[model samples]
Target: MRKQRDIIKQLTDRELNVQLIISQFSLVFLSIILSYILFDSFVDWLNYFKLSYYDIVYYGAASGLLIVIIDLVFMYIFPKKYYDDGGINQRIFRDRSVGGIFLLALLVAIAEELLFRGVIQTTFGYLVASIVFALIHFRYLKKPVLFVSILFVSFYIGYIFVLTENLLVTIMAHFIIDFTLGLVIRFQKRGANNE
Candidate 1:
């Protein structure tokens, strides 16, 4: 653990960002390949993307708005217990432009949803998928509140996908949550620096 922490500490912001991007894309690619091998059909694993534009728009908007609201409520209730670790703050908000943050969040959302909801949830059901989702977020392990919150969010995302049979909804929700939180943290840090 000490060695791992030291390694993480040594990573520069740009290196960290690059690592994150690579990891997300790797997850996406690996999930697709594994899903095809196990299910023998990409369409079987990725059926959630088959929807009309109107349905996609409606479900995506609704899911995103709902998740944002829930996240805000949780943050309000336990401000200090949220993603208060300086590591996440630095990785997400510090030395990053707004567009870069949004793009990073978008990629992360797509990759995570594809692996967790698109393939895992479709195969293993919601409970197992949610658990796997929360487990992969190792940072949350040290923060109990954040861990529980993430578990709930994962479950909710799975539920939304199951209900609507549209991966776009969960992807949109995940993107909105990450993007909004990144912007909020970035501006808050900037404001603090200004003061």
Candidate 2:
């Protein structure tokens, strides 16, 4: 696997095809992490938000952790189909180092939830921002079924976050889903090697 710096360099400077995939996934993962962090921190920074026991247990801890476990299982069981692994085990868990990536993921997820679900949807009163959020998802996903599915999921997540008025829940849900997708490819490779 390319060093994170090299991958970033290729996208910003080299514009290499190989680098494009890494760059795309990395950027997405990074964004999610940042969103989550900001979502949690910004509210606290302003003394406007705090995670309640309900939020922590139902949204952050339970939903997020459970989703991660389920997704991880699916990912390992069906790698070729589920995740965009790019045939790299490192992409799944990367032996080199994950300090930077893990940190970024958390931050991005927090910030993003704050913006997309907690702040955007809630502030806009769900209907308006939910439509906008669903529409934006169109660019990333092509299939009609997938697009609609994501739209519905987005709405559900937004609603839950709004109901709870906590970004932590949204971030947890998002992280669990995304992290599982990333793990899919690794599972595939592992099974192949064993066979």
lDDT of 1 by residue, 112-190 (tens): 9988988888888999999999998877888888888788888888888877878887788788878887887788778
Give the top-scoring candidate (lDDT).
1
Q: lDDT of each structure?
A: 0.80, 0.54
Root-mean-square deviation of every model: 2.0, 7.6
lDDT of 1: 0.80
Q: In candidate 1, what residue range of length 10 has the lowest lDDT sum?
A: 83-92
lDDT of 2 at 89: 29
List the candidates' TM-scores in order.
0.89, 0.56
- Candidate 2 to truth, TM: 0.56
Q: Candidate 2 local accuracy as lDDT? A: 0.54
